[model samples]
Target chain A: MSEQLATVTGLYGLLAEFREPEQVVAAARAARSAGYRRLDAYSPQPVEGLAEAIGHRTSRVALLVLVGGVVGCLSGFALQYWTMGVAYPINVAGRPLNSWPAWVPVMFELTVLCGALAAVLGMLGLNGLPMPYHPLFHVRRFEAATRNRFFLCIEARDPLFDREATQSFLERQKPLEVYEVPW
Target chain B: MTPPDHVATQAAAHSSVQPPDAPPPVLEPGHTLSTVTDKISSIVLTAPPPRSWYFGLAISFALVMLLMWTITQLLWRGVGIWGINIPVGWGFDIVNFVWWIGIGHAGTLISAILLLLRQTWRTSINRFAEAMTLFAVACAGLYPLLHMGRPWFFYWLIPYPNTMGLWPQFRSPLVWDVFAVSTYASVSLLFWYVGLIPDLATLRDRSRHRLGRKVYGMLAMGWRGSALHWHRYETAYLLLAGLATPLVISVHTVVSFDFAVGQVPGWHTTIFPPYFVAGAIFSGFAMVVTLAVPLRAVYGLQDFITERHLDNMAKIMLATGWIVAYGYAMEAFLSWYSGSPPEEYVLVNRMFGPYRYQYWALLACNIAVPQLMWSRTVRRTGWMLFIVSILINVGMWQERYIIVVTSLHRDFLPSSWGMYHGTKWDWSMFAGTIGLFLALLFVFLRLLPMISIFEMRTLVEEEKHVHGGHSDTSDPRGPAP
Candidate 1:
């Protein structure tokens, strides 16, 4: 129901193309300052501070990694304790059933294993990847986004968006070309 | 392979600039973002592999066949088919395992440690180094599983519940090794895959082949280089690097614990953990040199993997070699300082026993030979470093052999002592694993972008920005279409 306007508009966004990364970044910052929301910028390589310019704050990736590491730590120790001390106790050299020293290596390994997995997987999930079909790919020149060019896209879903106003605004930003992202 | 310095001189001859005293560029100059992407991705996308690649892979594949045959025979017959016997139960199998595992350390050091240290130069070699780590670990893993005698029941090492009411002995260092090694391999893979994603996307986008595009696209997980995605990816990559640093250290330490925890006079050393880790890095860099020299030459990638990279890697090998040499000195010093007759004999017997020649050879190869690296000229000369790296590889293997065989063959009881020798099966198994390692590496080079394309692009941008070269718009390829 909410995307009904977008459906009527028959578009994803207006993409502004630029030769230099600084151009796209500045344009994205300008659009955001002019009260545009739901925008993204793409570049051939990571452009420093571009995400922030496009209305994203600090990413949750690190926090999620921290949570994953904690979960791995607790579970790793729990598995060892339950297996060794509670479930199948083995008395060796008169040591206690719950010998924590012996558990360190496996626990450490699991913490790292689970933590590393979390870092990669969490980043992927947050990014909404495996999205093989994206409207941006429809722009033939958009292929250059992964090569040598940079782009700023202003989605039609933004409240401030108007077909004419947005296109003209993107043009005013001095893009090489402003593309209508036909959905 | 054309010598790297020769390539460097040629590239320099082409450029004909830069003051004499200035440091060599990590990446050769004249690369724009597009140019860097094109050069790297073209290898996977357009450039046909050279004939030498095929010839090398054919040899490696044949060796892989040899490995398969060796494994089949071992499984059919039993542990008895090999020469491992009473005193030297752990011969080529354990020695090769340690050597291969140690060889993986430099990759982790290059990828995770160098990344953390902000070593921008690592960008060119990190991808293949990480891949090398995965393959080396794979090769190392085979020896232990095959040596288990009953390879089919190898799952018994895992700490899972069973009807028989058995659990892995948690206290054993062997059990700890199981956890450590598996964790290291998986983490290394994840790290490698995560690193590869952006480059895979470049391959996907650049690929004209239908099948290649689909395969790379799936692996890339639709990475479109959105600023948001790169932000998350950078964070995740940094976090993984942080976790991998300690994990790499712990892996070798755990491997060393397998010997240190044992009561064998020579094996039970206090310095084993640090010494083993040092030796691991030493051998690992040697292997990296062995791989990198040919890689740059065959692919004409001297522009990316410059002489500076070679010089830096050689410097690291020299530094770690000194650490290993110090470990040898301390180990001998402790032997006499303890005044323990058996411990002292272990050292003396290593020098005077039947295997005394191997001990001196080990010293000469590991200790004396690498001393050539002290010369700046030798370190920069590609072939000399290559020879040194090979010798170090051999010397490190002999160190492990001596540590495992020499100590076990002549234990406390003189009457119980017996000479041990590796049968053909042992040598075949060792050579076979090398084949397996090389075959995996060959396939990786052919299929994937050996250098990270996006990272190289980023490095170019950073270099440009640092020198205020960003506004200069004379791209040889011209503005993107």
Candidate 2:
């Protein structure tokens, strides 16, 4: 396997967003030009063209849910059928070996349960929750993000990241301030 | 290209035109609910509905009182008053009970699950749904106690140390049902109350009378809408949502056990839990549609409870309908394929036997009618959905009847293959429960805020992503007065 190299050293995408959409767009373009592929942007909310500006396309979450849901449904049906029909069949009044009809509701519920669980847990797991520490929390004004701010982060692990060049590049985009994230 | 600062520029432009001393609150940039919410505010948001609303309420209350009277008479007379003969021990009382319980599922699903999912559309309908849940469950819970004949000794259902040395059978599904339903009710109330806290606060601030203010204030839990308070409140709410979601699943599953755990061939199926849950949601959504369509028209929440919300719920109904249909198919296939005569007999009897009309009715309402929802226009239209929802509710009730009375009516004994017919008292009691359910809901509508104000406010903030725009070089200290 080829060893992966981080493009921009130390400095990654901070995505210093403003309330105005134009400001966010302009900064995104400037970061791209500053040779910081690892850079990200932030905003209080979604701007129409923000995804394009950040050079990303689509979320993988839905695919995960679909796969998980299908797997869940199949497994659920198999488990019930295996237990009730094959493993330990209790024949009261000479009922049949495979009572498939009674399994439908449980199968359906399990599918939904699994699908929902996958959607939630997969999201959290992929996002890596309970971090308890992030450099962004150190910023006082960052608290306002929960209220009325939008932001995007391009991790230092991104191929285009560079410490000094990324910082200089972000500075040119007219951001409020760029902070280095230590992960 | 200039990013369209439609709101910001408009605000700035409007500010220049306004008198210098005018308040900034008037010029806030957000697209307030004024247009969307205001169109139907006179109709939807208005409390006490109208004189006509009260007239309906009065009728319902009267009917409920009649039901209570009937109950008193039944209690005085004995279980003999309900015409449940040998084969059909369970009658309208149990059917109505399951029907009401089935109706209750939609409320919890709409309010808790949708809220957790951050579905914005839930805002318009959740309050009403929660009220329906509380009332429907109340109606459902009355049956088993009243069905017991001597209603006074209903506490025997609850496990307690008494003068009698005998303990309640923990192993029995009936005992589990008492815990299940009661726990469901308690947890649902807690979830409902927690969700209402912010709305109650909104009502507290908005109320005209001093007593109203004080009353709502107390219920509002001294909420000031502080960030810290909201944080804790939200954390608790998420936890409760997590708890209630499973409780909702478990309650109906446990209820199914009342039959499934029995030795009856048709009743003893592993599919009871999920099948029961789906049926519960199906009946519950049907009931919601039945009530909401009329209430939406009467209360004037057309825009808020928009066609979109209706369409979504209809889709859900359609989906659950298919699930139930599949359940029926699977049951039939198994009955024949398993080569079990009794199982085959139960399935055959349900379809072509004595109570074949009920089987067809269930199929028509639960399976066939909901197929109409696949059409966008049918689902979006109020009257069409209302009719369908009503039919579905009736069908669901019949489905329970088919499951309980029909199956029990023809036990393993070939000699006792007789049908169970519901007496007039049975029909009257069912009617009475409906009246009771509606009366409670009507009262709830007048008393509580039918919408969550705090949650709505959250949507505005959520619309704006925290990671939104670029501000690369502006110094933190730089500002303008």
Among these predicted structures, which one has the highest TM-score?
Answer: 1
Segments in model 2 whose C-alpha atoms lie over 4 Å from true places: A1-183, B1-48, B461-481
Instruction: Give all candidates' CA lDDT scores.
Output: 0.89, 0.67
Q: Mind giving the per-residue lDDT tens digits that candidate 2 earns over B1-481?
A: 3456777775665445444443222112232322322232223334446887789899899889879877877888887878787788878877888888888999999887877787777776777888889988899999998988878899887545567744444345776677678767766776777677656655554556788767876776554332223333444566556656776887788889989899786887887888889999998998888887887787666645667777888989999998888888877787787677887789988888888999999999899899999887888899999999999988998899899877887878889877678777777788888788888877777787565544544443333332122112231211211
Candidate 1 lDDT, tens digit per residue, B1-481?
A: 5699899986764455444645567988778988888988888778888998999899999999998999999999998988899888998999999999999989999999999999999999999999999999999998899889998899999978799988887788999999999999999999999988888888888889999989998998888989999899999999999999999999999999999999887889989999999999999999999999888889999999988898899889889999999999988998898898989999999999989988999999899998999887777777888899999999999999999999999888998898888999889888898989999999999899899888888898887775554234433322222
Give Cα distance to truth, residue B370, candidate 1, Å. 1.5
Q: Write the per-residue lDDT of candidate 2 for residues A28-63, one digit (tens) a residue.
A: 666566554554554322345555566645555565
Mark the 10 consecutive residues where model 1 chain A has the least summed lDDT.
Answer: A1-10
Q: List the candidate 1 regions with Cα displacement exceeding 4 Å.
A: B1-21, B469-481
Give the TM-score comparing model 1 with the true structure, all chains together: 0.95
